[model samples]
Target: MRAQRVEDTPGGRLPAVADPLRPFESRSAGVATTERVLFGRLTTEDPVQAVVRRIRTAIGLGILTDGQKLPKEADLARQLGVTAFSLREALSALRDAGLIVTRVGKNGGSYVQRPPASDSIAEEQLTGLTATELRDLGDWRAVLVTYAAWLAAQRASAASSDRLASYAEELADADTAAAARRALGRFHVELAAAAQSMRLTRAELALHEEFDWLVQVLLRDETHRRAIVRTMLEVSATVRAGDAAAAWVAGEQLTAYLVTELTRSRLRLIAAGSAGPGPKRRRAGDIVAELRRISKQTVGILEDIADDVAAGVTMPPTSGELNGVVARSVLPRLGRVEDLVHGVGFMAEVGLLPEAEYWMEWWQRASDGTFDRDYSHQLDPSLDDFYEYGSQDYLTRPRATGRPNAMGPYIDHGGVDDYLVTVSLPVAREGTFLGVICIDIRVAGLERALSPWLARADGTCLVLNAESRVLLSNAVRYNVGDVLPQSSDLSLTDVGWFGWVVARAPEEP
Candidate 1:
């Protein structure tokens, strides 16, 4: 334990410490600083992809303007908490994509390249798309934009509202097609931003990037351009007024207009044979109509069940008495229910009914003698949470508002463990809410019913719930419960399953 002599370096002298704790403290401090910095930048996986996404998002959002020089590679790498090699790889990908260019020697660095003209870029991106694919892309954009507008109306701040209005005004005043298209795109991005959801904003940026060319094409027509600007202004005004429903409708109208234009353009291209001999498109119209018919019928059945329960049960039974009553009364009615009805039950308000007393059809055979016994009730924590009064259970809203409602893309009741949609009707008598009558619709069965229709569709088809979680898919790429990635080319048709249905095709060829 001798004290070490201080050593002189280029600019400073460092005293050699004999105390082991001093060196440990200094090392720990260095580690702590490094960890903090890394925590800010490091993603859980795929640093290169993350870096690329960040830069691309910045560019797409106009945060990084054209010809803006990026920081030196080393500095950027350090900031992103990635290896220099990874940064170089990401930069290389960007360069390949024509988003950036690298220069060598003095004053040399990576600079963003100006984007290609919108029409040329759009033509290139859309070169291979068939009419069906273009229509589907339009539909998907419609859903996303409409939903974003609705949410923004509900939650946007005053500043966000003002910004949206300003963007709309700018779009209206834009004299040139290019200027109008740019403004229109910015208006959408700002609208999504007003929703106060980062995911939505990112999605908007991505969608705009994907369809910039299409917007350019549409904007070139003076009539179409003016109409779109007017639509944007109307949507902005609705959002500013905080009319969520109106905003949603406005957004949908705008989407419909755009989709119509796109469709006409696609048809023209097809007639010109520029789109090539398109794939044989199968119309899902009949199948969709059939599905809607079945869904409505099922909902009607559930409503009748609720009405029967409300009329029969004069007084709310205690938790201990509910199961026995349901067994004797409700279970027999459920027995006669359709085979597609996986399970039917009554859920009492929490604390009013014991968890075990929630009546569910557990019989293997219904009263109609069908082999329908594949259901169970386990005390799943998630299911228990769902049964609570304020939960997203179909019954919750119905019970609260005295209106029927549907909720889904959720797992089975009581954690029985199957993806299903629940349609519930409020059981009320004389203005008193008793409980909820719920019917579980087997998503698998519905998919089976639609199998013929899905088979007819030109490409793969997915039925996605409100959360965009797949309830069923004929595509090998997706499975039940898989969340669909946001893409422009996915065609979405709203079917009657808890605001879910028919997402088809993919962006890739």
Candidate 2:
């Protein structure tokens, strides 16, 4: 204990007991403080392991990219709130772990590196994970990246989007696991960066701590790398195109693909024999691809219609001139949409055409938000349509969020009179909510293709639409149309962009 400087009697003169927990002395350059929350403020965990984990995670995630110089020993320890000795210990451990290289002299410090993904290393990291853990990781990552893409669509400048595109190309061209790993992590961080949210970028960095290195193990395979690059490009395209709704959809699909890859990579390590093509995920992907075609199609049509509005058309007032505008500008495209486009109904608001059911297309026998189909997708691009497009759960959701959506598996009793799922992608031009372009797929058709998969699992299995309504089920305990029951035992696996696989927990043996 150091000598106390007491100012008064009765022990008041004693130097206040130095609080061990007293905030560390601030330096000329203060610690960049994300602290216990966003940035890791290690507490309760072993100091050496925590430092190792944090650095490994940073390097893996590309937050500290390859060859990036780390701060000097004293500064790093101060920033991490660890002792100088502990920081040195962690650095030595990292060197042995192949995550960093160190030098011992003046102008020498730790430099970040990405370790090779050997089967041994990957299994060591993965062995402790349960299937549930894998699923949850994918879900949370999905939420972050998807929301980021949507905001990026609205906020990113052209140069930023082009940069994302360039990054995607580099990922596709990567010939090594380390290169791919860095690109993949960098893409997510840059996407968050494009969203322009420092908090989001930091959150993404936090996620990398647990997942980045593990994901690198999967990136080693060229097939997985190519697959991810394709999805990244898709995401970049939508963001570049400035279609917020479409960007969000593409983001979810990308995450679903990542989730599938992570599962397959896990299987390759553990089951040995079970690793092969994931037919269910592939089928779900095909279905999603079929449904999502409309976003680009709809956006194109909206742009064309906007051009018409821009080119030399006089704003007709009250002289049936507005009727003429609808005829010359709107009816043709709405009456006959692209081959891939279809609709179950058309609902419009008057500012658009005064509740006009501008008939174009709807019956896409296939699929969509089990889709952000933009519930979107839509009423023949009419909302401003018949009394049909009400401000309800399905019709109004896209308009409000300005994002694509999928809703239903409920009976369209008053209309189609059969159970259906509606995929809608919203249409907006110049920030005006025009309406949605939607397709109606019969839930029965989905049930047939999905039944066997749902049945393969031992316990209760269900196929759910965007909203937790059961679309298909293997057990009678819960029938179609019932909202899925909440239970900690239930684990929901996303089946592409359109639906989820709700699995019943295994019973105690």
Candidate 3:
């Protein structure tokens, strides 16, 4: 007997297929003759891999539905800007992977296969990964999702926001686990698309292809599915409200929860001896020693700048004129010492200067030269309070009654919206505190300094303040100013002036 020809429908059933040649012929001849260029040429060195990625992505995204026939070989090759040989190789690989199927004779063509349950596929993939790998994957996704949500909040139109909200609602209303998982994936991809960057969207799609199976697995538990849906709703609401920072936080929280779930599963697997051993965890003491060295180096630079300001540059008790001179002479010196220093200035006691206003000199990396602002006039209350007495009282208060203060992750500084950390050394002569010599450093700069050490580890490293707000993090999941949860997995060490370094190995055995 001849084999029964089968095709998968959206409803997940194989139907008795008519001649595939009939569908091709019934469609306009132009349909076969013409080609639709969905994306640009493959730039990767391995053209076959690139071709495979594009087709797999399309299938994952539902751009090519199950059983949908691909274009003719020649036309597809032309559209993808690859030779027929390369395209065939990619197709063969995809077929081997069960992503596509092929038939023979006049009706022969490549058709997308009905993908397996995402959770089942994801569980299979997870079996081969070590604990550390899973954690790293989770951290990577968190960063991408956070950034995508932040950008989306900044650039999304009202209509786009509405669509995101609608997707969230759809997820909440999903009647089955399978339906909910699909809705959840769509919402995330749509969120990335709203960022208005095609590159980011493509990156997000790649992540989905790898991680969607995990998400599907998670959604199998009714309670977990509900919780995830709630988090998605929160993200949508934050993005729709146009709060970029809040949206980022929401995205991070969602990813963190997902990571926690995956970690628990990994631990269970480890106990079962299903997974092999992972890399050795780095000693916390080693990380602390390295951070101490970096902190001392930073403090040494600040102290030298302070000495120059206190000696050569004089701040006359009542004359604002000397403020300019102090800035001109000292700000340039501060800039010379460190390229990462964002700004340097002196804040005088109120009414000590001629203008009865505090003097401030600020320099941004983007700015050509130092500019002046009113330290007491236009500064945010949180910052103004910090410089005046908050620094000595809050940050430096613990070390010595009187010493330098490092205050950070402050928003609304230098007339721009950026997170900053300031190191202030009280400049005093003869028991009189002349003013505080303050240096501003972008939090991003600090992260770059610690990135090398972080890269050596198998988990995330966060530099956080005493209050648990982040100062710098290797995992972009937590931004400056976001509060971190206290967990037993986190190895917390005090870095003195900088704050505590919280290292958490996601793959900890």
Best-fitting candidate, scored by lDDT: 1
Q: Which candidate should be chosen as best, given TM-score against the real structure? A: 3
The TM-scores, one per candidate, come to: 0.44, 0.45, 0.47
List candidate 3 stretches off by more than 4 Å.
Answer: 1-38, 104-107, 173-179, 273-509
What is the full ranking by TM-score, best candidate first?
3, 2, 1
Cα RMSD (Å) between model 2 and the true structure?
Answer: 22.6
Mind sharing the TM-score for model 1? 0.44
Number of residue pairs clashing in candidate 2, backbone atoms closer than 3 angstroms, sequence gap of 3 or more or interchain: 40
lDDT for position 477 in model 2: 45
Kindly provide the TM-score of model 3 when superposed on the true structure, using C-alpha atoms. Answer: 0.47
lDDT of 3 by residue, 38-69 (tens): 34456678999888887886666444567777
Tens digits of per-residue lDDT, candidate 2, 117-213, equal 5656655665445443565677788889899999999988776676667667877787766666666776777788778776787677667656655
lDDT of 2 at 256: 79
Off by over 4 Å in 2: 1-50, 62-69, 106-108, 111-114, 217-223, 273-509
* CA-lDDT, candidates in order: 0.62, 0.58, 0.62
Poorly placed runs, candidate 1 (over 4 Å): 1-54, 78-82, 116-118, 175-178, 273-509
